[model samples]
Structures are given as structure tokens and as C-alpha cells.
Target: MAPVASPTLLARLLLAVAFAAAGVAAWAEHRADLARRAEGAAFAKRYSIDVRRPSFVETAKAEATGDLAYMPLVDAAVQDAMGTVALANLEPSARKAWIESAQELTAELAAARGLSLSGLAARPGWAYHAELLAFLTYTGDRRTAPVDLTAKSARWELPARMATRLSPGDDATWGFLAGAYLETWPRLPERTTAQALPILQRAFEDPDFVRRGFGAAVAYLGVEPAARLLPKTPDALRTARDIVGKRDVPAAARLHAIWETVERETREKDLARLEELAERGDVPGRRRTAEYWLVKHPPGEFDDENGRREVGRLVEAWPEGSHGPWPRDPRAQLVQHLLAGRLASVRGTALARLGNQLTGVPDSVRARLLLAAGDRYGWERILLESGGVGSFDWTRFFTELAARELAAGDAEKAEEALSRIARPARTECDVLLVRRAVAREAGKTAEEREAEAGLALAVEDRFGAERFAGGRTVSPCVDPERWADAALLVKVASPGVSLVGYGWDGGRIGTTLVSGEATLAVPLSGLSGRRSFSIATLAGPEARASEGWVTTSTGVRGDQPEAAQAAPLPPPPAP
Candidate 1:
């Protein structure tokens, strides 16, 4: 319009402008691509991703270029890296960023294959790696979050499900699955075992499986099953012995299995087996089993009037000093004494053998044995002497002695014993019971009422409606300052009996006793819901004692009948 030009020139000018505009647009796109490449490289370096190889970032670029063949390689490498990564070493913020980046990349790769994350996860082989990535992310998040049993179950579900899909020869996957099942067994026995048993049974039958670290899982499956699965080889026996020796196996089952093995080996006259059992300070179970055998078959005589001396002959057949493992086992020695002390003829010898080394015996056992032997002097010596004794043990010993003294019409001696107990905010129920009795004998009605109020408060603290059902039960004993966290609800079949819950607290055994079917709560410190503990019921002198108590590893729920069995309490010595 500015100049009247020829038609050809006008057409050439229009073409030139169009070419310039195309050049500018191309340059801008090139710059943008370079920027994206830089970003991808930075991300790869930050997360320790190998850019030289096909990674998630590389796979994305290849996908953009319409190359789908590299998808599987990239996916596998990414998953391998993710699984081996030390996410715990990363800062929290950095960890969050890395997890987010991984999630986005996984989504992109999954989309490239015409599938969603769920579809990819369900797919077998390399495609299943995406689910593992997702699981890794979940575990990472859990590192920073509070995890309970439910959350743990959720975390395990993915791997456990993945494990089921893997081929039978995949020992690595199976081992991991078994470990997870073992960890949650106490909390979710049925759910874990149901899914795990069939697959594990198959694996256990395969000898190749034990070449890896599958022995422990087999043991956890059960001693009988493991024994059946494994062939009778020295290596198999050693593996079984090692696995059965672990504390993870139930003590009763472990002891039984070990005893069976020992019996079999003894019948075969395997000196190596005996030496292995006598090997000091390795597996405590082996030593314990040997000690048990010694106790059952003492070196001297059988309980027979015919005096067959069969066990003594067996001991003589054993290499000199090989049968002396029981001497190293103090608890077994005390048990042997307790059994020997039951008879009047050997009672003095047993008492002398017990000699001042009463460390391994519980106060209850000591009381029972000494009272049965009518060794009042020995019983009083243990009660009065407090060296190397824990507070809980001291309190228990004094409480029992005080009760016997009070029952024997010695109020002053009972008072002296009661005074020795240090009154903490919480104590064994037996302490309060004895305190109330001592106060009554001393004719102090107010003191007796105070002790009774304390006991009532303890009962209410654990089992009251205010704690359980949000309904207040006002009583003179209610004290807000002394409330403890509710842990377990314990109920006995009979009323008016004392129950004691025992657990390890800071490497020392701590006990809480509540009388008359009250709830019991051990302090939370150094205690876990799955930790094994024993509850011992102590009734008044007339109650018949049960043979032994059962230890439970599970937490008690509302009104469960899993109360402690009563242990024998021998009658007080004659005055």
C-alpha cells in the first residue's frame, strides 16, 4: 500500500515475512527444549539416578519420541534403584520432594504403556515393579509418620500380595514375606498365617529353598513341620537346632523339640551331640535343654524303690564331666532343689545345696520351698537380707513374709517387714493387702482405711466406668493425679484373689498386682503390645495352686478370660 509495486514483488515480500516468523517460532521451541533437558538432568543427578542408562526420565524422553521399546528396561532400573535407596538418610523435605518426583514419573511411565498405576501394579513381571515403587514410597512416608499394627498391616499387604504372585523359585520374595508374617504374627495371626502357610509349605518342601535364608521361616512355621520338611542330615539338624533355639519360637515348643532331639541323639549314643549341647555360652536353649535332661534324670538315683539306677548308668556312660551342664544352670539347680526339698529325707541336703546362692529362684519359689521344708530361719534370712535385690523383688519378699508373720500372730514382726517396703505411687496389690492387714493388727483404723482407699483407687483407675465407658464413678479413693494409661483388662474366674502382671522394664522385671478381678496395666515404657509376659494369681492360703502358669504375648482386650493361673503358696511355718 505504501508503494505501488509489481504483483510478483508483492508476493515475494509476503513470502519473506512468513519465513522470518517461522524462524523465530523455531528458535523459541529449541530454547524451551534445552530448558526441559536441563531440568531432567538436574532431577536425575539430585536423586542419584543414572542418566547414562535408561531411567524414568530417559524413558519419558523416549516416549515423547514415540519409542516404547525402552519402557521395560527403564522401569526395572528405576525400581531397582528405588528399592536399594537409603531414604532414611535423606532430609525430610528432600525425601518428600524425591517421593513426589518418583510418583509423577511412575504415573507418566504407566500412562505411556496405555495403563493406569493400578493396572501396571497388577501386571506381572517388570510391570509389577511399579507396585514395588509405590510400596517404597509408602514405607518412606511411614518413616516420618506414626505406625500402629493396622498401618503395619497395610504396609505388609502390598509385599505379601506381590510375593504370592511371584514364582515358586523366588526364594528372596518368599523370605521377605515370611519375615513380615512372623513380625505381625502376635497381632494378626489368622490373616497372616492363612495367606502365608500354603506358599510357605510349598517352599519348605523344596530343598533349594533352605540354601538361602529360609530356615528361620520354616522354624516359625512350626517345629514339627520344619522337622518333616528337612531331610535327616547333620546340616539339617544344625539348622533346625539354630532356628528352634531362637526366642521367637514359643518356649514350650522350643523346649519340647530340643528334648526330642536330645533324646534321639542320646539313644543313638552320639557323643558329638552331647558335646554340642554342653558347648557353653552359645544358644541358651541348648544349655537349658541339657539342664532339663539332667534334672529329669539326676546323676544319683531314680525315684524307684527297686533302685534300677538306669539314669545313673546313663550318666556313667556319658564322658566324664559331660553330665555337669546343670551346675552351670542356676535356675535348673534351684528347680532340682525344689523337687528334692519336697521329700523330708533329702530336704536338709537340698536346703544346704541351695546355700546362700538364691539368685536364680523367685521369691515365690523360695518361700514355697523354705516353708515346705519348715526352714523359718532360712526364710527370715532371705526376707531380712536385701543385698543385690531389686525393689520389686524386695517388696514382694517382704510382703509375703509380712503376710505369713501376720497370720502367725506376730504383729510386731509383720510391722517390721511392712516398713521395709518403699511405697511408690504404684505397687503390687499384695503390698496394699498386707498393709491393710498390718494396720488392722496395729489397731490404727484410719491407716487401714487409707490403705483400703489406695487399693480402691488402683482398681478404679484401671477398670472404672470413667476410664472404660466415659461414665464417672465418684468414690473417696478417686484421685486424678494418680491416673495411669489403661493397657490390659484382667479378670479372674474367682473373686477376692490377687493377680500379678510381670514384664521387663529397663532390663529389670517389673510387676503390677491388682486384687479381686481388677484391670491391670503395666507401665508403657520398655513394654510393647506383643512382648511376652506372665500373670501369676495368688489366692489366700486355702486356694489350690495350679501346676504352672501360661505366658501370653498378646495384649488383653475387654473382659477376656486369659487371666493368670494361681501358683502354689505353701502354708506358713509353725510358730
Candidate 2:
């Protein structure tokens, strides 16, 4: 052979070359690591206070401000729901107590330097007013819906007295409060053409009202025989659609009530509307029947105004003997339907409000979103999707929630999170597969980690191709998606050892290999140009290894002498 180069220099050259290649790799790995860290960091940085903690006397701070007279109305509506006619002992006292409280609050509300049914409308702080009104509208006594008839006289006099100071639609919060309250006034619905007429007329005309208010006004009018006079009154669907046009209503929830009504029809096909009507034997049948009715009736296309009013009247006209789910919460019932995903509009409204608050809909609502979401998944999905994560502290969000459960602590939550993060891989064999092929390949520095996090690399089998057990496995070491080529890895360590699995694209699926290691070469076929990769791992000894996943993209690994499977041989014959 020709004179060989100096071993030291040659080694140096080879090492320099190897290091150069590795440096590129290290940089990529470094960046990727940084990226994962960043995501964790960013999520961590945007902290949120945990709301699940036990109530403390020290935190008696008010959650929201601005005009909030309607809040009690909504709470009263919910409480009123307990009055379903089916009560064993109809608490006449409870009814009287509730009505009395409502009437008192009404008196407080009747006059205003600038207050009305829409007390919170002028100030956005009272968006909940719409829902409160919506709730009360459905729950309030249809026949006796008019607050004490005598109280009507007092309310009427005050509206006129407060008329000049009464805010116009320009003051949205103000108008909504005034107009909304007035719009629902049943003081003399028979006298809809006179007396309390201006309030109703004004409530509907005011543009400041949320489209929800429009639906409310339409529904309210539908109950009065005289509502037939508003020649321009649109149907419920059209009203919702028109309000949708205002661009004021959130787009996602625009037809939520409408859509649910559509779905409710199909979902509750087998469900009956009344227990007595269903001829069912169970006692809960009454509640179920009421629930079913809520599901069955939804405002549809063109049925908007009158349709809504009809539902209200149906509740109003329910047979007096048909108690139990009784004194029906026409409005609360509808919201229940909406919440149950029966009525799209109602459900949409609930989802939107909770979603907003969870995502930082401020003041009082934000603090109680979890309470509102009530540990429901759909609510959580909406909460997560809306960039709301940034609003709360991830640490507190995850940790504090743990404190309440007697079984869990904050550290336990962290452990749980880690467990959740590691849960996908099915078997230690699978974990080892990723570990041997991916994790052990190279080391990374901080600078390189930052650089690679942002770059785009073609990663095949990135999500494991939805295959059952084989193919490229996922790298738990990284976030988002990172995969590796499982074939080219050479199992140097025992089946128990783990190694870095390299994908043709350079991305890898890594975990710990408790005992084995699979050294691998850069997969050239499936990988091309700039790419990212990770060494492998098996999670940990104590933790059961979960199943693994691969990238969504299929990699084109060139035909090469692939490593044989490192299956464990059957144990030696007894002893």
C-alpha cells in the first residue's frame, strides 16, 4: 500500500471529520432539545392560577364589577329550576321566598339613573346578563311570569321617571340592562300594546343587544298575542343569522343552538318527552322526560321568533297536574338542552362563555371556568384550543388541581404529567427499539438545540403510520413528532439495552434502553438534506414502557443490509 498517513494525524483527520459531521448533528439535536424545552418553558411561563383549590376566607374578593343586577336573576332562575312540579313536598315557601327575592330585586332594578333589564349591557362586565336573562326567561313562570302584578305598577312608574337618564342603545351595557329587563316584563303582557310597551319595543330595536338578546326579544314577543304585529320580526334562525351578521356574535357559536337542535332531533329519536306521557315505570322517568323534551325542541330555520316563543309557551301551558320537572324551567330547561349538546345555540353559548372565561374571559368568570367547565372534556377542549393556555400558569394549572384530591399532591401531578407523556409506547421491546435506534447516537449543546427547533426537516414515519406494533417508533425524548429508522440499527447491547434510532430524515423516537443499545448509521434513503434526530431510551426501570408511534410520513429507506431483529431467545431449560 502507498505510504500510510500518520496514525495520529489520520486519527485527527478522521476525528475532525467525524466531529464536523457530529457537530452538524449536535447542532440539530441541540436545537431540537431547545425547542422541546422552549415549548415546556413557554407553557410554563404563561402561568395560570389554579381555581380548584379550596375556598379561603382571605380571598373574599369580588370576581366582577360594573352593573351586575342581573346576576342574581340568573342565580334565582337556576334555583327556581328546583321547583319542578314533581316535588314530593312542593315548597310553597321556597317558591314564595324565591318570588319575593326576585320581586325585591326587581324593585331595586325598576328605577335607574341609568339602569334597566339590561343593567350589564352598557358595561361589557355583564355579558353574563344575556345568559342570566336567557335562563330566567325559560325558568320564570309563564302564566305567573309577570312579577307580582302590584310590583308592576312600581316598575312602570320608575321606568318613566328614569326615562331621561335611561341609556340609549349607544350605551350597550346600559341599554341591554334596561331594555333586556323591560323586554321580559310580563306586567301586563295582555296590555302588550300599551303600558309596558315602550320597553319591549326598545329592547328589540336596540342594536347594542347581543344577538342572544335578539333571540330573547323575539322569544318574549312570541309569547304575547300582539307579537304578531312586529311586521319585521324575523324567525329564530334568521334572527340568529342576522345577529351573526353583526360580527358582534362569536363565529364559532353563531349557529350552535341551531345545530344542536338539528342534532337533538336525531340523537333523542328513541327518547320520550314525558314520564307520564312515556308510560315508563321508573321515578326518574319524569326527569328524563323533561330532559328529552329539552332535547327534542330546538328552534329551526324560519321558525325563529315564533318558534322560540312557542317553546316558552309550551312550558307555560304544561298541564298543572304534569308536575315533576315541574313549574318547568322553560329557559333553564332550554339551557340544559343546550348544555347537553341538544340545542346548538344554547350549547354554543355555554361553550363560548366557558371557553372565553377559561381562555381568560376576565373578572369573575375567569376564576370559575374550571367550575363552569366542571371537569368536562368538551369544555376543556374549547378552553385549550383558544390560545387560552397562555392566560394561566401551567405549573399552577397542573399542580394546584392536584391539591384538592386527597389522593394527589403537586408532586404527584408532575409525576402524572410525566407518566402521561410516557404512556404511548406499548412495550419495553418497543421502547428499546426506539432507544437503541435513536437516543444513544449523539450529544447536543444548547446553541444547536435552539437552531434546529425552528427548521423544517423531512421526517418519514414521523407518527408511526398508524401501524399496529412495528415500523419506526416514536421518541419520547422529544415533543411534537420525531421518528427513527428501526432497521439499520445494530444491537450492540443486549435486548435489554437501548440505543439511538436514526431515521432517514434524521428525526428519531427515543427512550431509555435499560440494558441494551442499538448503534445505528445515518439512514440515507428516508433522510435527506437538513434533518433532526434523537437517541433512544426506555423511559425508566420503574415505569412500565408504553407503546411507541412513528411519524405520519413514510420514509424511503434505501435497500441496505438491515440489522436482524434482537428478539430475546427462550430461556434455558429448567435450571
Candidate 3:
């Protein structure tokens, strides 16, 4: 029988069997897909969402870049379709229904991912419940519309309190209450405002609420009432100042009463009082003083006499020690460095004085001082001499020096500096850009000066570092490495390697695997005044590694300004 059946016939039979099995598997997969689609459609209809839209996918995937408005769509849909008159205010009948539906949806999603609703709430589900509560309380409708003042005062309070109650400590809670509180301000009924003022005032007394939702409360109370309600007595002001100094109070709302006191007493220009506040060890006080000084004496106001006075003031205020007792506030550090730079410009002995003054300062801060003074050689010297204190990066220093030279109309000097950067053709798109610029400025023949525009574009295309690198006629440097805490987008070529983030002090932050794109948002509160961060890729067998950093100032509410991003550095030059 084996001899009778040819090997070809046997091979064909096996192939036919495999195809039949594949057909059955494909049919099964298609049916399962249809079932999922049907279920998704039914859910979308129940919630009034267009599931076919790209936004729905973004919402479902819970992308950080997804529209905030889409976050509440599902809950809003359910509320609109199934919500009753009393449900709008989240009365017991409405509350129960909303919670049940929310919990059901959350549970379904969690089950799919082998998690619970609370676990999901800690991640993606946060936007749903938190935003829903914010929407219902803020607008009293599916969309952000005018609140019906006729509704009972308790109706709005129910959802506002429930937001925190549901998702405390999550970004969703803080973000939702932020919007909710702002909305409540304009629509707060006369009766509710009177009844709730004391409650809101008490809430602000807690450092937690102040950190999380004080801005909204301030908005809700209106400036005058908020000022009146905030601590006013000397002792109370000291205590309140302490809270603000801790950055527990929202930056704008922290010193409302103290500000009112300052404004009433000095029309907001009481530099003497502001300096006294700074002397009292208040961070916000230092910030306020720096801001006022910036306004009073903008960048071009630097002069010999003023520079001397400012330098003297900074030296006295910010004496150096073994990393002890230095003014840790970023704003203070900046003002001090700015004065140092001005002093360096005016006085030949400024570098000597600054070196003495900045002894024992943090490496990053010292780096800033050299950068500010435009002392490229000084920076280079520091980088070479300092064995472990973290030196100024050569590429950055050269890039800046070249730009300054170009700006000063010294094309030769600029070309020299640009030429100093190693492997300029491949290492940095900016370096190549500068090289082309210098060549053009030097009036080289078109053939001799061939602008490596194609090479720069290829590098940008390969690394996706265009945003940080391209279109720079000058230094194009994002300065002052310290940044407010915010999300950072990390893009890598492949998966598996563990990416680690670090705080300003070089402390290891949370880690994630680089499966392509990841967003890292570290809390600046614990980071204190040090907002700079570094990201490193830990190499493994399956990993592709690149190590680099970017800096930014911290944002309001600890938001990171857009500049706090790390672009992929160019790969190593071929051997």
C-alpha cells in the first residue's frame, strides 16, 4: 500500500488537510471578530458614541494624547440616554444607576486584561469615572453646558465630592476637580455659595486639598471672598506661607491672602516686603521676588554698577556649603546665576569671584553659570578639570559657541568651533546645520560649501529628532536644564529593553519597557525644586540602546513644559 501511493500524492493530501483546517480556523476567527464588533456597536449605541471614529479607538486605548472631551463621552452617553431627571444631579436613583454602569464597564475592561475596576481606575478607567463626575457636577449635563441654577445646591456637591471619593490621588481626580471647580464658580447659586463657602474654606485648610484643588476653590470663591477667607493674621500668614513654600498649595492660589495683604499695603511692588518674605525661607516668596526683578530689570538692563550690586546680593543670599543650606528653589538659583553672568561680563575678575561663590554648588547649577556667562572655554575647562562633578557636554558647548560666533559676525571663529564638534556629519543634525550655515557665511563656492542638507535630513528621518534639532540658525539650545515635572515621550526602535528615568538628584525613578513609544510623568512634588530628569536605556540581549537627556522647567500644577523631552540621539558612527 505504501508503494502504491506516491510521495507526491501523500504530500498533496497533507496540504489539503492543512488548508481545510486553516479554513475552519479563519471562519472561527471571523465569527469571533463579528461578535466583538456587535458588542462594541451595542455599547457605543448605549453611550451615544460613534465607535467607527478614530477618537473612539483612541478613547478605548486610553491614549494620553486622546482628547479630554472624548474621555467623558461614554459616561455622558449613558447619562443622556438612561439618565432620569434626578439622575442629572446624581441623586440616589441616578447615582446607583451611574455607578452600576460604570462599574460594569470597568469590570468588563478589567476582566479582559485580568484586572479589577480599582486596578483599571489606577490606569485607564481613571478618565472615565473621574471625568464623568467632573462633567455631571460642572455642567449638570452630558456636555459642558450652563448649569440649571434651579437644581438643589446639594445636587452639584454630590458629584464634586464623589470625584475625589471615587479616584483619590489619581491624576484623574485632580484634573477632574480642576475643571469642576472652575465651572462651579460662575454658576454657584447665591444660596449654595453662602452655604458652601465655609465648607470650601475648610477644605482649603487641608494641605491635600490645597495641592489638589485649591485653584478651583479660589475661582469658586471669587478673588475678594477667597482673599477674605484665606489666613490673614501674622501667625496665620506665616503658616500659610509655609504651605505655599512646600508647593502644596497651587502656585497661583498659594498666597492669595498674603498677596492681597501685599497689594493693599504696597500696590504689589513692595520689593522690601517681598525680600523679607524670601528671607523667611518661603519658596514662593523667592519666586515672586525673582519675577518682580525680571520685570523691573529685563535682560538688557545689565550694567556694571547694577551687576556689582546684584552679585553682592546673590553672594550674601546664596552662600555655598557642602551641598547644604544653598537656595534650592530653581527660581532663586536662576536669579543668582543671571547676576553671576552679568558680573562676569562687567568685571574681569568676575569668573574668579563666581568660582569662589559657586564652590560646592551642584554640578548642573555650576554648568548653568558657565553657560550663562557665555564662557565656552570656561565650560570646557570645567568639564576637563572636574573628574566626577559632571562636566558640560562638548557638543552642546561647541554648538552654543559656534552660534554666538556666527551671531557676532565672526564666520571664521564659528567655523572653527563647529569643526571642533566630533563627527559633525553624523552625530547631530544641529551640528551639520551649523556647519552648512558657517560654510554659507564664509562665502565658499557652492561645490566647496555643499550644505549637507541631505545628510541632515537623513539623520533627522532616521532618528526622529527633527523637533529638537532642525531649523536652528544659532545655538537653538533649550536652556536652563531644570524643568517642571511633566510627561515625556520616549520613542525607541524596538521592544524588550527596560528604560529607566531619573530625577534631578540622579535618583532612579519608575521604569518601563520600551515597546516603541512611552510617556513618563514623574511627580515634581517629591523632586522638590530639582525638575531636571535623565532617561537611560538598559541594554539586554534583545535591546537597542541610546542614552541622552533633555531639560525643562516645571509647569503649573507640576505640569512639564513642552521643552522637557528627550529626542533620539544619532547612532554611533560606523567603525
Candidate 4:
């Protein structure tokens, strides 16, 4: 050592050096703070974000320490994330972290602001904050997100409570409340409906709120309850109707409103109002109302004066030229003309209308209309084309057509028309009458005899010979006793023609073969009731020709006839 120094001098020299270093560190921190402030100001100006508040400074300090109690932080973060590209450039983990922090901050701010009504009213920006919070809560991962204000644990009444603080004349506040409530309604607990009604009622009382299109929150309460909440005035009813008719409303709610309105209008006997609603075909609710009205008051028979008036009323009220698969069950088109007792006046129009329809028109109704219009060709075409199907009553149509053709002297066409009859058993007498006349007119004596005998069997089968003995159409050619025995005489014009006779009960009985001009008896005792007979030629030039007939016996005869009874014959082999 060159010179020993005193302890006080050495200590003073070290303290000076330490003080200098401390000053330099303090200066560096001050410059960093200044730079941060300047950068924040520039960001606020460039993005038009309002950060010129004490809360922003507090938010920065809290963010560093992981605290979230300020509202301005949420606003700034949302503005930055939504308005700038910086968020998109963030890495996935950083982006997630930023969003989570923002969500927690928003929840914290909403809960704090919602606790005091006076404070919420003093600051109108809280309304926007509540809206942002609702948006965030509803749009976030809803199951685990912290922002469900509607939850029982959360401040569920924040929006409604804020709405209550709004002055009666403050339309803007009312609109905000309604909009926020509407947005959050889907996630709201069902238990909240009672709580929400009062707030909604207050908001709707402001005309400007309704004018701003925020009055639609009524649907959240559902139809019946919502209807009870509305004013009973005509304007209010109309407004309710319009609101419910919007497509965004639930269909069940809309239908309920429509039906309730209809019931009220009908109960009050407000026909004009009801008709007005019915005519608005564009509104599905009103269209359903019109359909209900049509169904309840159907057009009765035209013979009654009251019924005719109803027809006229319905025709006038029909929503024509509108979107309709019209309820045509009442046959309104047909009855409308029949109301005036002027069938001729509507014949052409009826044909045109009926022609346009591919289905749904009854065949009998169309045919009668065609016949009335002297469109015989149309009637005949329908019968021929339908081929005894649908609602045409084809048996009757073919029978009538045949009789008409016979009277018109077109015997060939008459016979051809008769061939198309599906159930000849139903119209057997009518068919035989036509056939006998056709045969007599053609000078076929043998055919006329055969038809006369067939007619005799039919008459006896229907009305027993004892029931109408004198009025009988023809005498029985086959003895009544032989008929009971299921026996008949085969009298072919040519001899040695082979005949195969068949009987039917529930099923086909054994067949019997015999030569022509001989007595043929079938063992039909097993049959309980009347038996049917058919003869087919198995040999000779008339091979495979068949003729069917029914026996007039009401009971089976056990006694066998001592005639040339034929044994059961096997059918000819297939070719």
C-alpha cells in the first residue's frame, strides 16, 4: 500500500459511485415510461380508440399484474382486436390468451356496473358496455364462458334493471334495452319470462321504441301471454298481428296468435275485420285464418236460401289470385253455379275448369256435367279410358251407354258397350233387357230365345216366380224342378257337339262333359245356396266357346235325376 486510507474516506468514495449508478437506472426507467405513453397515444389516435382516461393507465398496470377491474380496457381491447390486423398476426397461444383476458375483463366490468342503478343511469356508456357484454357472453363458448348474465349466479337482471332506470321519455335507452334483451333471449332461462315481462311492457310503451323496430321482443313471452300483455286497442291489435306475422317469429307462436285473434274477431262478430285479415294472403298467419274460416262455414246445399247466401259470401271472400292450393272440399265451384239454378250458364266454364284438373274431380260429377253440355263424346271417352275404375260408377255408365246406343239403333255399338260392363251381376236385368232387344231387332230368332230364357232365370233368381207370377218377363224354359236338381237340357242346334258344364259355389266344382241335345245333370248337392252354371264346348267347330248362366234354385235338391248324367271330365291338355 502506498498510503493507508481512513475508513470514512473509503466508505465515502464507494457511496459516491453507488449513487451515480442508481441515478442512471432511474433515468432509464423514466425514458421507458415516456416512450410507452407516447406509443399508446399514437395507437389511440391512429385507430380512433378513446384511451385518454385514467382507467387505461390502471388497465395497463392491472394487465401486467393479471388484474381485470376496468371497463376501458375491454373497450380498447375489443376495438383493437376487431379494428386492427395485429390480432390476426398473433400466434395461436397468444391470441387465445388475449381473448381470454378480454372476456374476463368484460365480465368483471359488467358485474361492477350492474350493481348500482343510479351509477348506470349517470353514465349512458354503460348501456353500450352491457350490450357488448351480452354479445360476448352469448357468442362465446357458452357452456363454460364467464359472461352469462342470465345465469342464476350472475346478475341476470342487469339489462332489465337498466331498462327500469330509463326515463319514460328516453326512447334511446328503451331501444337499447329491447335490442339487448332480444339478442340475449335465446339463451335466457325459461324462469326469466316472468321477470322480463315488466321491462318489455315499459319499453313498448315508448312509441319511438316501437318505431325503431325494437318492439319485437314481445315474441319471447310466447303468443298467449304476449297477447294478454298488449293493449286492447285496434292499433295495438294490428301491431301485434304484424309483429307475430314476421317470418323470424316462431311458427307455433305465430299460429297461436292468429287463432286467438280469429276467435276474438268471431266472438265479437267483427266480420269486416275478419275479412280484412283473411285477404292478406302474403301473411301466412292471415292465410291460415282464412283457411280456418272457410272450413268452419262450408257451403251447404244450394236448395236452401241460407245456403245460397253462404255460397255467395264464400265466393266473394275466396282469396283468388293468391298463393293457394285452395281448400276445394265444398265443391264451391259447382255449388256456386247451382246456387243460381242456372246449370246451362256454367256448363262451359265447368268443363274448362274440370278439364284443367288432372285429378280430384269425381268421375260421376264430371260425366254428368259433360252429358248436360251435350259433350257425349267426352262422356263416352271418360268411360272408355277409365275402364271401370275410379269414382266413375263405371257399371252404371256402361249400362246406360249401352241402352242409349240400342235406342239409337247402333246395335253393334250397343253390344260392344255392354261388353265393357265389369260387374254384370249388379246390372244383370238391365243387360238382359238390352240384349233381348238387340237380338229381336237383328232377326236372330235362336239368339232371342236364348236371351229370353236367360232373362227368365234372372227374374226368378231375383224375384221368385211365385212372387211375381203374372208380371214375369218370360216363362221358364228349364223346369223349376230340374233347376233345383242343378240339371238343365243342352239343346245345341247341331248334334254331337261336345259340352262341358261347370258349377260354382265358393269354388269351382267338378266339370261334366256331354254330347249336344241331351240332358246334363251336375252333382251340386254339396253347394248350400244357389249354384252358378257355365257351359263350354270342348270339341267340334265351337271348341273353347263359353257361356255362363245362374240357376233359379234357392235350395239344393238331394234327389238325383234319372237323366243322362255326365261324369266329371278332365280339362284338355295344354298346347
**Model 2 ranges with Cα > 4 A deviation:** 1-166, 169-254, 257-575
The model with the greater lDDT, 1 or 3, is 1
lDDT, candidate 2, 154-259, per-residue tens: 3333333243233343334344344535455544356543554454445445434434354454445432232332223223333444443233222213343343
**lDDT minimum window of 10 residues, candidate 4:** 468-477
Please tell me which predicted candidate would have the highest TM-score against the true structure.
3
Query: CA RMSD for every model?
Result: 23.0, 37.7, 27.6, 27.7
In terms of lDDT, which candidate is stronger, 1 or 4? Answer: 4
For candidate 1, the clash count comes to: 0
Per-candidate Cα lDDT values, in order, are 0.45, 0.34, 0.43, 0.45
Backbone clash pairs in model 3 (N, Cα, C under 3 Å; residues 3+ apart or in different chains), count: 5
Q: Candidate 1 clashing pairs?
A: none
In order, how many clashes per candidate?
0, 102, 5, 0
Writing each residue's lDDT as its tens digit, candidate 3 over 442-517 gives 8775622354543323321112234322211111121111223422333333343333323232223333344554
Best by lDDT: 4
Q: Give the per-residue lDDT digits (tens) of candidate 4, residues 87-164.
A: 687678656655554545444333333322222333454454454443333333243453554563244345435444
- State TM-scores per candidate: 0.28, 0.18, 0.29, 0.26
Clashing pairs in 4: none
How are the candidates ranked when ordered by lDDT, highest leading? 4, 1, 3, 2
